[model samples]
Target: MDAVAKEIEGLTFNMLTFNVVNDKITQGFANRIIQIIEKHNIDQVIVIADEVEEPAQFLLNLASAARSICISQTCASYWGGEPLFLGAHELSWAPGMFERKMDKLFIDNRLFLEFLDTEDIKMLRERLPKIDKKIWFASTCLIHGLYGLNYENNGCVVQSCISDGNEVERGLISITHSSRQDERFKSLVKLREYHFIPYPALACYIEY
Candidate 1:
């Protein structure tokens, strides 16, 4: 039992969940989120709730566990509370966009968590404007190609992964390899701006 517990101790995961509704975000909803996290031993989470009225209080209530949080751009007025400087940004993009491709929201939210966890604030800030286009997981290659143009001018794309450094490298290299053979992937990296650092392979944002 002790050995099993030890093994479990090493396991942790970043989670993402959305409460998409027209009603205001409430404390009960927040509590339920905490319950779910504890139940799964979640290390971190990205809570995406929409149309929160008291954004400040809602966030403050979650101050204990929510390592990285995001509210919709439409909720801007309610966010007048003290900002945690935790990548608190306006979700100015169309809701339908995220509704269709939820994985992109998960990735975008986790990117903020990674920046906070790795203390790569400067890189995040510098790349913030560019993220909306490149990091967004589009449903089509045409979108990827259009965004790839901006990605090249901005330099390299760096992102976090669940695996070790070498694995990250292999994954990225695989993508580049596919770019050569797959028409969609090919257009995405046409500029060769596909140069990317899948850290912890690069180990630090400075290397990007």
Candidate 2:
């Protein structure tokens, strides 16, 4: 498990990412996130996970434990399981998908392009300046395109997966406008290699 904490502006941001091995490990990771939230007195928490049943369940467990909010491609109301603590928001680019329940909203590169065509993209660019709220961009890898598209005052959290031989590792890279030019922060945008294979992979080959 790996974790990093940084204070951006006046808010404390705790970023954590890890491979999902089993229920035990996921529960432990949830506990670790809770510990970090308590230690730092973090007020806002955002948990993003794939739409798969197991991962979504794990995401709910972590969010429930931390009493934090969640954002995903689908609405939390559709996640249907244990109730969320602080409610949830869906990331949407289409006007029809927007709901009154969504108090906070953000956009991601994958979803933006998938939903919008050439003309839509151009129109969005023209009207972007008129929007008042800061739009956050979430990506699988920061080194890919969409690194600097976020508003100058807003920060971005990128969760990426790295596969090294049979071992798979996931990590979160948090970057703010203030730290964009810092050499130390820029150095983190490199490929990571892990030596040992996780125990769950011993029985079969897991393709990332």
Candidate 3:
């Protein structure tokens, strides 16, 4: 197996390739995967490696129940683009600004159900039953009844932040540059085993 495949096997997360020419799954890869699985008490995992010009769609299969989700961005050494996908919904994006009126906020469900590719969802459900249970959206995306698809399941809960029953995706911005001045991000880190999702420019904020 190649170095990349070996490292992936060591992590014990299932591997999928995108637009990569070397599509060889060597015996070494299978052996290493078994060894890692035997060594750890793992419940579920899904890992994806992308080598194409296409967007990183593998992120859509992230383990929501997991306390932390790690992404090694190979696109541009820096991260920044489309503040969307920072919510608890599958194949959905949050609005730019939330309008609040009469103590109740108006957050629309801008769902592209056409993006709900049933085959992909089925594949994920088969591999990881608890997929997309709770998403790692930004604390800012929290607007009432704005949880996109996550709400359809069972409302939603915010981890590592204030526990609000609202279904909004989030709009809580992360403080950048001054690590000392960012109380909200600091508080989030204090929570036990919080989920880790990365925004392009805000990727630096995730301590772990």
Against the true structure, what is each candidate's TM-score?
0.29, 0.25, 0.25
Give the least accurate 10-residue stretch of model 1, judged by summed lDDT: 138-147
TM for candidate 1 is: 0.29
Q: Score residue 37 of candidate 1 by CA lDDT.
A: 54
How do the residues 1-208 of candidate 3 rate in per-residue lDDT, one tens digit apiece?
3464456554644223222222322334434433443344333322222122222222222222222333221221122332222222243211111110111011111221122234433332232223223222232333223233221222222222212334223322211112123321211221222223323223323342
- Estimate, for each residue in 1-208, the C-alpha lDDT of model 2 and write its tens digit: 3434333234554432332321233455656655566566553444433233334344444443332233322222343542222122221232211111221222222211233333543343344323343322222211222223433323322222332233232211222223322212111111122212122311111112
Q: Which regions of candidate 2 deviate over 4 angstroms?
A: 1-14, 21-90, 93-131, 134-208
Q: Which residue pairs in model 1 clash with each other?
A: 73-91
Order of models, best lDDT first: 1, 2, 3
lDDT of each: 0.31, 0.31, 0.26
Candidate 1 vs candidate 2, TM-score winner: 1
User: 28-116 in candidate 1: lDDT tens per residue?
Assistant: 66556555555555543444343454444444544344433333221222435422222233322322232222213222221122212
